[model samples]
Target: MPGFLLHLGATVMCSHGGQATPTAPFARVTVSGQPVTTLAAPYVIAGCGMPPPPAGNGPCVTGQWLVGATRVFAGGLPVLLQSSTSICVPTGTPMQVVVTQLRVSGV
Candidate 1:
């Protein structure tokens, strides 16, 4: 599917409400002056509301992108899009892309 490209400034959050940030933004690609994200890097999460073990499997710490733009490549890696799918580690929850660069779209 075609969707807005995910940039460093994109608002991405885990299912538990933890904010997800790309550990390494692909500097070779830029969207609206911000570096674009790719499947090559993982995302670190913070401020997760999920409780610890014995209560709930939560507090997502990191994320890995399982899907990305099939046709758009940055540094030989697929660029992440708003429609990309990701999995948060330990929590087994998906990361949600709430906001991304509207100016750029990729499949």
Candidate 2:
């Protein structure tokens, strides 16, 4: 499937609603005036309110992209896409790509 490339400015969040930001962006490529992200980078999560302790699994702290554009490469790394799948650490929840550049896409 084809999807828009994910950039630093893209709106991504954990399943629990924590905002996710890529620790590293591929500076070699730009989308919507922002650096594109790759699978090599982990996302830092913030503002998650899942719960705590025995009551629940609690907030997600980080996320790692498990899927990306199979044919798109940035600096020899697979570029992240809007349809890319990710999993949050500890919580083992998936992240959601809410908004991203609508112009550039990859499969």
Candidate 3:
């Protein structure tokens, strides 16, 4: 039996308030008709800090969906896992969630 772990890039939302909206619906990390990585249970929003707008003139955006998430598509099915707490995803920054970790036995 063999096992493997792949990372599904989950996009973080940038907005004020709560619930980080997924930038790309969900992070896709599966190739072929085989099960790749699985969404790691319990998502955590790792705040990707942002600096104030340039000279107080740049567009200032606040991140509410703090908790990072990891999602993917398996067997044509969608798997999404979000964090309980929130994390900041400052503007002009790219955020990703480790949606899940899939374990398969290559028998």
Candidate 4:
């Protein structure tokens, strides 16, 4: 690894029982640690903003795995960004993360 890392954006619709909670970043989403926190099926990243083609080349934020499946996709918490994840352009840039409701994913 010596180039770039892509993080795909995903639209997670976490619901408690049957009520839809506010959707936020993957880092702000959780499923009570039940039925396994990870999504059962390999969910294709949806509504992501990952760059298309290659880094510093083609369309950016338009790639298939688009959002880039950043570490946030792994944690699925309403917390802070993983050290591995990019802090957007211009590192050390102050960012705001919102803590949504207890994101419950039933699947």
Question: How much RMSD separates candidate 3 from the native structure?
Answer: 11.2
Residue runs of model 2 more than 4 Å from their true location after superposition = none
lDDT of each: 0.92, 0.92, 0.33, 0.23
Candidate 3 local accuracy as lDDT? 0.33
Candidate 2 per-residue lDDT over residues 1-107, each given as its tens digit: 58999999999999888999999999889998999999999999999988878978868999999988899999999999888899998899999999888999999
**lDDT tens string, model 3, 1-107?**
12233233333333321223332332344423322333323223333233346733213233333222233344453343333233343343323333334442221
> Which of candidates 2 and 3 is the stronger one according to lDDT?
2
Q: List the residue pairs that clash in candidate 1.
A: none
Locate the minimum summed-lDDT window of 10 residues in model 3.
16-25
TM-score for candidate 3: 0.23
Which residue ranges in model 4 land beyond 4 Å of their true spot?
A: 1-39, 56-107
Residue 63's lDDT in candidate 3: 32
Per-model TM-score on C-alpha atoms: 0.97, 0.97, 0.23, 0.20
**Distance from true position, residue 63, model 1, in Å?**
0.7
The number of clashing residue pairs in model 3 is 19
lDDT of 1 by residue, 9-90 (tens): 9999999888999999999789999999999899999999999899988779999999999999999999998988889989
Shift in Å, residue 20, candidate 4: 15
